[model samples]
Target: MRKHETYAQQPHIRIITGACPHDCPDTCAWQIAVDERTGRAVDIWGHPDHPITRGRLCGKVERYLDRVYHPERLTRPLKRVGPKGSGQFVPVSWDEAIADIAARLQQIIAEYGAEAVLPYSYAGTMGLLQGEGMASRFFNRMGASRLARTICATAGFEGLTYTLGAALATDTEAFAKARFILIWGSNTLTSNMHLWPFVQEARANGARVIVIDPARTRTARAADEWIAINPGTDGVLALAMMHVIIRDALYDADYVARATVGFDRLVARVRDWTPERAETITGVPAARIERLAHEYATTRPAAIRINYGLQRHAGGGMTVRTIACLPALVGAWRDEGGGLQLSTSGAFRFNRNVLERPDLLQGREPRTINMIRLGDALSLDPARLAQAHYRPRPVDPPVRPEEAGPPVKALIVYNSNPAAVAPHQQAVLEGLRREDLFTVVLEHFQTDTADYADYILPATTQAEHWDIVKPYGHYYLMLNRPAIAPLGESLPNSEIFRRLAQAMGYTEACFTQSDEEILREFVEAQTDPVFEGITWERLVRDGWARLNLPQPFVPFADGRFPTPSGKCELYSERMAEDGYDPLPTWTPPATRRNADAATVWQQGWLFCISPPAHSFLNTTFVNVERLRRREGEPSLWIHPDDAAARGIREGALVRVWNERGEVHLRAHLTEDIVHGTVLAPSIWWNKLSPDGRNINQVTPAEESDMGGGARFYDVLVRVEPLAVASEEPESTQQAVSLA
Candidate 1:
């Protein structure tokens, strides 16, 4: 045998540790091997030592070897040679790329001010050090722009914080003790597959699994009972459930009298929302609603597995608030497994005070803007622009304004694709197209967002980086050590940020700290008695660590809710102070009651475009040949009745249009979705069609007036078959429609 082959076949192998940074619930830790001589990755597997993942890697991370070694992976920097989003570029040296980025950013700061350039990102990557914290510090030090990230989880956090004081949850390991598990608006089997095993274990140990959703998902199919409700009517169902629990005297009288302050007001509010009233709003039958309420209340240990999906509507905050109150009412917090379980990870501790350090930038002004309202901020509407107060300011300007436009005149996008991921793709594209705004993208391949960049920088895969992860849905900390060197010239996000900081002449304590030093600093900053003896080095060696808790069942017992009033504030004084309802109340989503719904969905109603896990995630895995071939072209899912009503047969080309925009996709008629709602996975427009089949084309950018969460599901649209084929190929099975 050849010497290399013999060496490769040896039992001994090197271990590379890293975690998948996608905005997923699993947060898997990966192990990779490298050939000693060639220094090439030979194998990839799940970390056996990982606490939450437990040696299980998802399809996405399992294919990281292929993704890193893919022929099309960006190996060097490239400069745009054609118009924005034209997919034309010329290779450039690292020096040239850095110089160009730095010069443009400096020019923008000098001219339009820092706020003109917005550094927008999301959970495309969730690495605590490299993803959000480091990026935010770098930009903040530069006095660039502050993107108010209130779109996704801010509303839920704000509401929960007001009620609970701190954003923490009883660890998922406590699931084994749960008597009843209520899965609400979440398909854990598909989205959070890693947690399914633990859930199953809990069920096997005599836990009743209940699913509450508008559609029957894989999770619902596996549940003991599936309560299918109407889209955007979750708030009403929750309120009605509260009414039933309160009316039947299911609540813990002692807990209510001692631990809760607003029971009287909440009781008055929910009195009108009977099971019958909820049945009218939500499609779930009155009997089923009552039964589910009874089961949840009667079960001694009940837990609600809340997902982020429920908050994707006009009244999303209110819905979340209503649901959050259920556990408190039943005094479920007294049990080990009976409490509200939102996505709270205790992996790495975060200290926001690090960002406020004066030594970092010494007085840099940052332009600030609300991230949820990006379309409006970038729009031509003079009134909206004025309202945002688009003005030039220094990094640390004297008078701190309430709202300013994105100060970043130039942006360095790493690990995110906002063009395809953000609401209203057209507006996001337009904002990037601003001639004065210089944009740089770090990516593995040319994505929808990268196609619009002036410069594209290569990035390393998870297997090629050293990192750590803590799941947002569970409480386990994991350490990741690099298995192999970055392919070609590709570097980890940390190296990239370090180089950028060096280039910008930032040498303060913040930028000077290495990744290891930062990790140590973060670990030391944690003062929570639960994490007393934990250290960064110990965490790295042990692979995983758990936060020590003293008698978990006693946290919310004895009327000890951590609120201003020392009780669960069902009637939030905070909300009332903000001129909003204090009680968890039901308000219909604006779109359903809007006059536009009738006009938009004249033929059939608009569908909620929840992207499938196999296909989308900021459009990263969708472009992969294997996954794409498996998924094929994106299909619009509609009920058989709706499809037949529009004279659109299954597999037929159809146009789905609303006021915002239109998209053409092959129609797949099924009962998987509700009667009035359609299901379309968010995919790349260029990959599917030129006429923007990207579902966000039709999704409105309206923020909930109550909590500023994205009103994504609050949309109305119609579906129809294309009349002609020559201009729009029927052979290709393409559909075309517009407002």
Candidate 2:
């Protein structure tokens, strides 16, 4: 009320250039603004000029400004003041927190060699230096425990690696030139909104868009034709299509003869999977399947857009492998508009240089474990524990007899929140609470995972950091510049690692270089002649840069694949060696209906949980009022017929229970979903409830050992209304919106 109490002056606008770092299909470039003096970001928008994103912002990114400015963001480091998972903590000075963390880590390393510590991270933040590089350098220098290289995209990469010898795809611009576009297992309109415009353009040019998915999605609604197959039955549909292509003699004989190997075996394997046979398993009609196969084979210059969701099944890897064989079989790779496109970023031209970096992790070689099987790795495997002592080199110092398991005496978590994002939340929590394990989490907020940490380090948001981000799913090379200073004692991930290295008294040159210097070193090691004249400064000035390649448009011309045989292998020998069918084959997932069933019925409804493009990023966006208001809580989406059959009402409290676990939520009755399937938005956990609202509770953690991913959709659950329902219920479940 005082006369001098004037409001602080906010900047008219500010700009910070960076891109979303998640493993999402749309790698968006963002612009953030802050008040000149207060150093508080007030507005955030999408970079309209970026070629890939074309200046569009999704709901999640638009509301992200609220997340950075949220009142509950961890401004300083903290130490646990109560029992783990109790959500009680006391603020501590940065010095004390860092010192305490360093002491505990050193003690653990001294008592049980450095390998006792495990550094867990993932696509939480995709900054090249901040996320992967910093963690890799710190862990390697300390001789920390090993981490499995591929968790999310292993199968997709492995499939492409063997077939193409490299995981590269044609450019996104080439999609317009295609005569037929096969969109497989990807909801491009909703999941990749920016790319939707491009597809619309392609459609305008008379290119037919064929959507193939288990559920009818937004993209399917707009497609020229929609093919709804059973979940996990994608391989079957792909094989059936191949059968029609081979049997009818629609293939490009000269192209196939020159560029491919093992055609006879692939032809033989697909012979039995006729459209009629596939119809029984996939639930898609035989006539439509035959029509699509013919159309795709006859349509010259066809492109396939494969999404990452398909890999989340037991046979996901094999399904991708099977589907990848189609383009090769039809000789689609011979044209610029042809060739199967899984991830169209076309960054393999640059990624080759990154893999060849000798100074990146010079002398560090540590033991490794599979990332998908974190629960098993942390759990007490008595037999494996007994054999642990006799196992080879790089062993962690022995733990006490009682402190058994996979020797993770300490953990350093960065970017990722496994407590909310991992398959089994309870198991991850239990592993983190190990008495002997010292935990340190670098986070922007007080997340569920950070709540249990021995020390919680505040990290700079994308707006408060400087680095270069090369998207895994897109071709744009983004330059992230610091628009504002770090809030409170928050630090960039790179600086944090540097300080940690100094604290540990380690002499590793890789850890000593400045961020710019490291980037320069990487830019100089370019094996791709296209980048021969480019520099880091040039990239920063341009805001973005495209790598030049000899044949930038077409990838597999001249019949020379990167495979050992220099030809695309429809029947991969590597898959055969791994005890899998060499030729692309199909088997019904355990979840599908039997042929004898009078009516098509599923044991449990398929749960298609996807990350909301707007208000969902694990636990990060839950605190944003606008986004949270728009998408209140998780809702179980069911078809009207299914709800009527179960005697369930709309907006009623429903309990969805499966073999793994059960959580209470609200039921949304709509015809948007298939009759027998259910859709739940993933990454919802309630801190207030004794039993949290995590969907993983009901999600089975059954490993798709074949694919190296989780079969999240394979779960079937029985839904029922709450026994006691008041007109105005005291307890309200979370609600999600279709928008």
Candidate 3:
């Protein structure tokens, strides 16, 4: 195959509709170019009519056909032929593999109870049916341990939900109508890309774009202003803004009095968080903070695009909470596009209970497990799971071990790569390596997580499956039809779960529904007036449709919030009952508190890891040869000040480390990052690096203060020229940078 050769082009080019299912906000509606002669997909292009995407695809998904046909894609069941983590496996027939897995699952359930099996997964594929539809039904029926799926947005979403409510806020489409847009902690151009065009449109319409981030990201570089605040101090900044708004009498008094319950209480609490006080904490000048607050207050249709990046720290939840309250303070909700825009999955109604029926549990409330604490869960003895040292993040009232059963004995991995993505990688890897553990990984590639699996089952790609799309960032409900036949023995995530249910002799009719049937159930259950005329037929024909919302979509205009009081919860009674501050507060990252942790300087340098590069999506494209070439190798971004201080030259290989772990990478000295902060992006496979290590090597297993989310940015480290060490490094050393 020549570099420019079109792989077996056909006489007729037929276009088929599909939606990208990778874990992303903008679920772009794309058309697959099928070659009639070869029966191969030639290209994937964004649909021109998509309201959000508008004919352009993100860089990561542009060359998606390459990913679909990648040579290393897993196509058959594999049995481990070498020692664990050796990446050695022998292909086996589906019958042999399914029987083996069914027998092992039965044995584990009989010996340690059903709770011994933990189903580990996340949004590797964001398709509604494949993502959680079938997986939930199967796991619940098995009476297996319950998993707490709150890794990325838990802290931020929980905090926002505490104030505004889940999936209730300004929609992404309203960004075009905003007079002022503040993008906080998000690289919109690189990550939430489709939204950037709208921001640009607003800018062209005379709106200002202000980006608040610790580093000067690609999006920040193109902004009207960039506030390089210290990490974890976002809450204090929001408070200071509120203080200015109240002290200067800049708030919408009429709106606040009618639409809020805690106006007076909030005013009193924020009186102390003055701009000067926040200046000292956030590193943004007091004058700048004051100006920002004034501009935001005065702007007619001010919109704030808050993402999950800042909340990756210990106080992430509180940070989002404080920031989310700002637009409400200025009465931004009165305008069609003027409010905080986080998620829009609430626009439609879905039968969630139908997808993952808890009724199938047969009265079993198993011990709740937090996916973030995989390391700790693996280390504790099975007998002690419900007792003293095993305190998993309690979702609701957590079930006791005696009633739920034993610790996890079998881990079923699908739609996620925990060994690389899970916090406390060392602990996660140790648990994966357990000889007694029966691990089953369903994946398209032999990922780091798959390397540890006792049975590796091949899973279908998005193009080879049927699913439904409901994006938190967009309002369209997309139906994904199978674009291609399943390659070899690969199966959709739903089919795998369905087969497992049958093997276990489950008599429930719920397990027998095909992916399409499950999708039809969800669609027919929709009762939201927003989808008044949006039948399944209309969606399939149009490829996408905006909800039947009002012209402006000013949902909370009349102060009808989703809260108990039907008003924004600035001072939440719910938080007070849970032993948290009713008013949002700030807590600095613990690692940044100690001055001499890695240096004699007053402040230890904060190593910020993000995937600003558009080439990768949390290790999904790490295996693609073309994308990796385009991205080059995983490298570290060091500030010029830090690079000069450490005697490291630009482009030279350097080592970065703390107590958690260490890695060697090429140094890129630039002013893009804050003076005291460094940056990196990735999802590169461990085998790609010379030392078999990546950024997570040094990232610890620290959980956030509120949501038990991984504290990824709460890290301090020193960068120096790479020097070969006498000792060997951990085998689990890997790389992943999600911006």
Candidate 4:
């Protein structure tokens, strides 16, 4: 690592290069201006040399200094002195906390088994070192139950893999040269702000940009056209587009013949999915669908920018698979800017074996529990464990009847806030309230999840950690050097886990590996050609480096896809073996549309989608008062007609409910959303909400088609105005068209 030195011009100021460790796709290479005298971060800005960042940071990250040095930031370990959900805790020394936590874990292991311990985590920090390096080693060595972390991206990632062989895509920089762009199911301006500049560049070059979403988002409003389709109906629209493309002979015959498999089967499969059929299902006009298909097929250098939002439904995986087939069908891969881009994550070939050290498992086949089903996993009766469906991933070996394992006795949570973000909020809180459950949370602030912890460990902020970051949106490897000393008594996550392992009497050398040592070992162990020139010294001096590839990195231009057939699989035999349909197909969400009148009545009236609010990234920055103020209060966006029928006035406090649970929110009437649908810009912390709950209360613990991913958007709820100041909100008779 580079040594920190004061600038010659300003003796007290030093600039330190680091990477943003948040869960965002844009893993920006940033420089933190630190005052060496005071040992505090002065400001942070994006690195000018980073291609995708372009010397710009998003609104949420621009004020990250406030977050790191916030008054509410946890600076000492705490032991809960009150009830589980009560925000009451007394400060404890690091030695006392670690010793007590270790003693409890050992007692649980002795009473049950090692498999009773579960480590719950996800992308709070997308860093190789701080995120999971030491924690994974610790859990694996302890023979704990494996957590299939599938809250986000797994379904869409698997879908892209089945069709395109890997999660490779057209270079993000190539978007500037595209003639046509489809911003499908993505609010690019908010979630992927860095890529918006490239989109704007394309627009300046006379390119047409279309947004296909249920709500008129900030990105949709700025697009050349917006196609309002019903939620979870993206698959039907894709199939309808293929119907027009194949029927009109707009597909590239030569490319399909040479570079794709099962094209003939795909042709017959999409024949029945006509534009007229999709019109009724997707709420898109048949004429408009036909025009979109023609334009996409004929336009050269056409590109599609899809996000993970579309894959949060019953058919999310298949929906992505169907959409991925379009680029190859039209020979879009031949151009630098033509192919579809779901993720560039596959381009990174990090040697996780060195970082995570799964070899610590030593062939222990532990039961894998899906993270999205935490509600069931925590509350499940040990006697019924054999019968319960944990729904592990297809690749995981099923737990035998004899190896059903004991109930989860210990839960160590880091990196994620499940109480506010997970589906089936009520069940999760119920599980958290269990007095027997030993829970420890490592966090910077007292988040919703932290409020339920037996012990709250103070974790280091990004400015006080050493990490290596890889972006899913771009092909860059960046390193983060600690910009300042640990605040108060806080420690990096790596050190916290290391201390726990020591307290547990673990004598493994891996447990003692420093953050820099772990990162250095992983970087040095890399053998892939992509890491050709990326070295520790280079990263220390330059902060970031792009993968060693061709300038315009067109991954699939030659059609040598990394599939079993060595070509794009129009019909995936791998999918068939995995018990999924071999060809692309549409599956309706569990929440039925209005066409199914009886089912709609059984479910709620309106379809609900809770996308990330513009000012917040999931539940990360919600605690920041400035950002929270910018987001205003948690509210539901409903169409004017639907609100009027429900006797809901604008700014009226309304109760939204379904079978699972309910939440109260102020209603904002607007035509920006589709009819019979409501939008909730989430996710608000439970304690901060007016009703002590958020949108997740109504979301079910349902899994998507392929990857056991959370189906957060596959939700339904009914909204009505609050009748009295303190009484329960009453429903009103209303009729709204779902068509």
Q: Please report the candidate that would top TM-score against the real structure.
A: 4
Report clash pairs, candidate 3. 611-739, 682-737
Candidate 4 C-alpha lDDT tens digits along 599-627? 45343478899999999988989989999
Q: Residue by residue across 408-447, what tens digits does model 2's lDDT show?
A: 7777888877777666555666776776567788988877
RMSD of each predicted structure = 5.2, 6.6, 4.4, 3.3
Return the lDDT, model 4, position 238.
95
Top model by lDDT, which number? 4
Error of 3 at 305 (Å): 0.6
Q: lDDT for model 2, please.
A: 0.69
Clashes of 4: 0
Q: Give the Cα lDDT of each candidate.
A: 0.70, 0.69, 0.78, 0.88
Error of 2 at 667 (Å): 1.5
Q: After superposition, how far is residue 7 of candidate 4 from its true place, in Å?
A: 8.0
| TM-score preference between candidates 2 and 4, better one | 4
Give the alpha carbon lDDT tens digit for every residue of 419-473 in model 1.
7767766667777787766788888888877888999888877666655665787
TM, every model: 0.90, 0.88, 0.93, 0.96
Name the 10 consecutive residues with the lowest summed lDDT in model 4: 730-739
Q: Which of the two, 3 or 4, has more lDDT?
A: 4
